[model samples]
Target chain A: MIKVERLVKAFGRQQVLRGLDLDVATGSITVVIGRSGGGKSVLLRHLIGLLRPDAGRVLVDGADVTRLHGRALDEVRRRYGVVFQGGALFDSMTCAGNVAFPLREKLRLRAAEVATRVEAALTQVGLEGMGSKYPAEVSGGMRKRVAIARALVTEPEIVFFDEPTTGLDPILVNTIHHLILELHRKLRFTAVMVSHEIPEIFEIADTVAMLHEGRIAEVGPPAVIQASPNPVVRQFIRGEPERAEGA
Target chain B: MTERPLPLTLRPLDAIGRWAIAVVEALGRFGTFLGQALGTILTPPFKFWAFVDRIHYIGYRSLLIILLTGGFTGMVLGLQVYFTLVRFGSEAYLGPAVALSLIRELGPVLAALMVTGRAGSALTAEIGIMRITEQIDALTVMALSPIRYLVAPSILAGLVTFPLMTALFDAVGIFGGYLVGVELLGLSQGTYFGEMQSFVDLSDIMTGFWKSLSFGVIVTWVCTYKGFTVGHGAEGVAKATTDAVVLSSVLILVWDYFMGTVLP
Candidate 1:
């Protein structure tokens, strides 16, 4: 379980989070949705210890991580796998090398065992047998799978996806959405996804938290979020009402 | 987290605050850089050849210019000293003067300065580009140390190349002086060779090699730091490449002075 308390972060004077709070239950898929620059990414960055809250604390299993550093912070980071908005795969490495990187570098595994895990993770992400290809040789959708494979290679307790579905066509987006859902079921990752794509994301997320005006406007199940009377929520949902209906 | 807003005072205090933040960020980068480099030694998924490639670029390929510059250096020194020696009816002293000068200081320092410009700048730009593109970050998340993978091999190459290049400079320079003194300055080969052999000392040769080894290390260190420290985008990379060469060259000169003062 993870808990956030009175989180406050500021860039100079532009306060992005003001006394914000949220919680994640074990094995739950929590999707954070918001407008652009609404600090959704900021909130996620804080969760992984990438960004320290200015005036609050992020507690993972009751441990305050706001002031953690060095090996302690790295241990916190190891608990979660982050897929950056840009995929952030090492370009110089081949697809398999990228996927196996954490295993080779961070985990102590036999070479043969590392190879086995890489193959398994790649197969899990539907990228089996494309090991030697570089990131450039693959399509955008394939790159995300590689990043996903990288995230899952270590079988992290949690996986944070930052704009995972961005820049993909509808079919590819759905494929990724399904991949996310299937990955959660198979790997049991506590998924934390941040996106501005409101409606369809809920299909994969167990719960939705609409980040607005620096705080979660509402947080609940998909059905509760669908019936929300909040005007900001209404406008965002209706703007993509057709997508939701199709979903 | 909600970040607090700052008022635009544009005051001296604000300037100081900005400077402090910048210093802290630089220190943070240095810590990351050192850790990554040291980490490479232990981390798995190592790329042995990538580091060797960097060294090859910085060391082996910069040879032609080192040779040409070193050859010309000895020739110029010989010509200048010949004229001075002639004024005192001692033209034969040109050989010993040129040999002593080349062996002690000019050979290693000048060759290293040139290599720093050529190879150091290239390495800095290449790594800076990698850094800006988040390639370095990608390496870290993979648990690979960028320093161990990229820096250690280059350091090794520098250690080997600097001494080798310095020897080339010393050899070419002395030979160039011999050509000018015996062929152009009207000094006999026997006289030139005798004076040169008599004056050259083991300590002088040792000083040059020490400077060469240290120079190689400095060139790579500065270049690697600049590349790794680049914070901005392409503009940051460009600035870092220029700074790498300029700072390393300046430091080489400073080291040369200290080596000269203390080594003898």
Candidate 2:
């Protein structure tokens, strides 16, 4: 559903994404695993048309989103839903309001119809009847669920999760991953998630891509990636630090 | 090869040059931001409800502060002008003096400054928080223009509210002057109002109107721009809010001076 070709991005003197290439299959959950600040979020931003690549192309459904802007870019983005690390739910809005936002903004649904979808979305995320509660009034786990509900309410063709499980407890992380898996099973949206959850991500990801030094070091199915011989991949999966020079 | 550093005498010049360049660059960015914001605001698919919500937030909510400030300012003017005029044996001119100051200059300038401290700061902090927390990004991914969703409405509200609030301030201030000059200071009620009626004209009211209208744009433009471009994190938001309020206040005063000089 998405293809990135030789994507290069830089911040001042620092080069973040250097000739990076990635492909996301339709109806597949692709979890991009990398070290913190390895341009994971930056790459995701490029895919979602939030960041313009210095030299590259991001093609979604055969159209290069990198070249799109204004109404064209917006048309492409209309099919996209993003979940930021902080949930990014509007604090002033209730959970239901947040979920209903995309629906109301994008679709010309009646209030009754919007409310019905919001209810279903909340319930789907196991937060039934919690729509009226403000984001601050909810727990961290509940907030993440609300964000997911908001993202999925529109039934987007593509959903990008930028560390949606970060800052959550291990149990909560597992719960979120399971919830994502359940949703994927039901809706089958093409998802590109940036996470560092290692083995936990492997369970839910149809394909796992390990990013190292601004490039994809390895990418394959979970079992294939687990058995890969690449030292960077092995070291990362094992959660080991780099060896000393000459060691 | 290693580069040589500038001498102490030249270092200050170098610093000054850099400062000048930075200021010019900032001005350029602000101009571009203003253009884009205006463009979005003028485009179709207008957010009528959002605009109305902001009108309430920026205009209606600011009523009490405008009233309080206007009243006190008029009262102070009445007191000071009475004392001054009494020395000249023209204490009856107190009403005209108070009315002219409030209507021509103080009304718009002070109202804008007050709104800057009140609504402007809040707007910056609100948008800055939204930026840092990724809500702005969320809006973008949802295919919504944050400028349209946020900036345009605020600017429109500012343009609408600034003049109205200034007028309110002027009215309240005139009344305040009446209370002080007529009731407290033993000035004749008819003479006080009668002198104001004779002295104040439509030209003076128009001056205040033009000044307030421009001040509205300055307040909303600077505050929204600061918030939209806030750096990052809580510290970034704090700095943006402080900068927004300070810059808006300064610009209001400066613009007031320019309008006072330029307008007939």
Candidate 3:
């Protein structure tokens, strides 16, 4: 389980997160949604310890990850797999090498084992025979899959996806979401994803947390959030103009 | 009412203060990066093959440029020195003058500048691109040290190869000088060779070596830091690469002056 308490973060004069709080139950897919620049990615960055909150705490299974440093921080990070917005594949390496990076760097797996694990992860992402291709050679959707394979190659307990399907077409989006569902079902890893796909992504989310004005405006199952009575939530979901100023 | 600005009397001081702060901040950040990169130079998870691969790329692949510039510089130095020496019937001193300048000053400085233009710019652009693309962040998420995985190998390779490149530059430069002095200017080969052998000291050679070594550190350090901390997008990468090449070249010449004054 992860708990965030009154997370306050600021960039110079711009206070992005102000007294924000949220939670993630163990082994659940929590999809955080928000308007562009509403700090959805910022919150995710904080959760992963990429950006420490200016004030408040991020507790990952009761461990204050922000306070941890050096080897302790590294150990905490190893338990996570993150798929960045751009896939973030090392351009110089082949797809196989990118997938095998964490394993080779952290694990003492044999060459044969590394190759096997890489192949398995690629296969899981439906990219079995494309191991030798570089990130530049693959399409945008395929690179995302490679990123997913790299993320899961370590068999992490948790995976963080930052706008996984944002840039893809509708078909590729469905494919990616289904792939995420298939992998989540098989791997059983806790998933915390930030997505812009509204009605579409609600189908796969176990909990949809709506971030607005730096705090979660509403958080519940998909049906509850869709039917939420809060004006801000309604206006946001319907893509409608505000009914009143500061309502 | 509009708020009043600061008094005009203190405006220049304020601007100066702001400029000073930015410079100090940049220096502090670069120093921290250097310290971190140095710390990881000998730690565990040693990527020996990666280090060697960088050497092959930075050292062996750079031979052609080093040779071309070195040869031209030596030939030019020889021609000019021979002409100047013949004025006072001191044409024989052409060998020692050209040899001393090549081995002591031109070889290390020119070689460093060339490498900075070629390798340093490339390194800065590469790292900057990685930064914009979030590959560095990917490494962090993987529990891997970017300094260890990305920077140490380049720095180590620069250290290992800069001197070798400088030596090659000096050899070609000396030969170029020899051609201009003996073959073109009708100077005796024995006089030219004998003068260089007698006049050039071990300390002169050591001075060039030391300078080139320092140049290697400055180039790699400045370039990598620029790339690692690039701002955002393609414009940022281009700016960082330009800054790296310019700053490294300026620092090399500045440091060379200081070293010349200090070294024997």
Candidate 4:
């Protein structure tokens, strides 16, 4: 339910996103794969109205979020949930408070109702009985889970994951991916995730888009992308460095 | 090879020009941030609890320091002023001297400096950490204005607390002066307070009030803005905190001078 058209963003002399175009289908998991600092997070920020593009437009559900500002931008963002790489849980808040924040702020529900939903969200993420603990008190894996619970608590129409599994161990990475898959299966929220999980992502992603040189080099279903003819795609999937010209 | 002599003709001028431009740009950004923060305070759906929480943080928590510093400052004034006035056989004027300095100048300026060291640094570090950690971004994506949730309340609290704290400082400082002049230095108690009552006027009180009010806004504004615009990483937060405190302290002193010159 999101479309990025000719999105161009630059930082001083360096260009990060150059005429990058991407489309995210409704209620599907679209994982964007790219090299580190290839503007994946920057692109995601633009989609979520966190960054204004230097040029081009980001349309979510037909409204050009690029043009929206102030209250209008906020209104559009209300439907969005983002899980930052660090989880970004308010450190001063307990796990339950973090999850209940959006509910309390946006929904203005009664305290009893907010607590109930927070508990349900925590339970859904296998974090039951962990609500009272502060984010600092939790393990890295549990923090990520808490972040996910916070994101999904509001039942947002779309969720953006910015390297949610970046610093986790292998098993925890798999666990998080599986948890995301399960949640997607249940909630059916449209997801646009930026990740470097490679083959692991192929199993969960409805569509995989490979970003290269500030553009989408390849995009298709998992099988199609795996078997693609493009050398860049092939090289990336094989985890090989650039070959010498004649070696 | 011998080192080449640096070109000194236009370099200094160019450096000055660049510095001037940078200063102007920073000022513009700060002004815009102040406007936006104040606007958030004026807007609807005001977060009353957030404002109260900040008052507790920036105001109530700062009481002990203000009192301690104020008391010592007054005692110092009493000691020094008594010695100076005694030389001229004008020791009777010690009360007015201590009272005027504390009420009109030292009270607001020193209290602000103290708060800058205490609450201001913490505010900057807290918000800077939040910025680097993406908590601010999280708030944004959740459709919450970080300015409203963070900046507005802080600015409001500053506005509320600065003057009140200044008043507290003035009172305690006067008492401190009384302790030193009348009790320690053998000055008559009635003469000390009676002289202060005769010389200190409402205008002098108003001067401190105005100065403290402005200092409050400056401290909170600079601190919050630095945190909100922190560069990146741990280093960024550290630098932001340092900059916030340093800038707020400098601004407080500078503003105090300007106000001192203008106010009655």
Alpha-carbon local distance difference test for all models: 0.84, 0.93, 0.91, 0.93
Winner by DockQ between candidate 4 and candidate 1: 4
Error of 4 at A199 (Å): 1.5
The stretch of ten residues in a row with the least summed lDDT in candidate 4 chain B is B1-10
Winner on TM-score (3 vs 4): 3
Kindly list the per-residue Cα lDDT of model 2 for residues B1-264, writing each as its tens digit. 877999989999999999999999999999988898899988888999999999998888899999999999999989888999999999989888999999999999999998888899999999999999999999988888898989999999999999999999999999999899999989999999999999999999999999999998999999999999999799999999999998898888888888989998
Please say which candidate is ahead in DockQ: 2 or 3: 2
Candidates 2 and 4, the one with greater lDDT = 4
State the lDDT of candidate 1 residue by residue for B120-176, as single tens digits. Answer: 999899789888766676555444456766787776678788898889988999889
What digit string (tens of lDDT, one per residue) describes model 3 on residues A10-56?
Answer: 99979899899899988899999989899999999888888988898
Poorest 10 consecutive residues by lDDT, candidate 1 chain B: B137-146
- Give model 1's docking category: acceptable
Candidate 4 local lDDT, B19-126, one digit each (tens) = 999999988999999999998889888999999999999999999999999999999999999999999999999899999999998999999999999999999999
Best-fitting candidate, scored by DockQ: 4
lDDT of 4 at B122: 92
Candidate 1: list runs displaced more than 4 Å: A240-247, B1-54, B61-96, B139-161, B172-194
Find the 10 residues in a row with the least total lDDT in model 3 chain B.
B42-51
Residue by residue across A119-191, what tens digits does model 4's lDDT show?
9999999999999999999999999999999999999899999999998999999999999999999999999
In candidate 4, how many Å is residue A9 off? Answer: 1.4
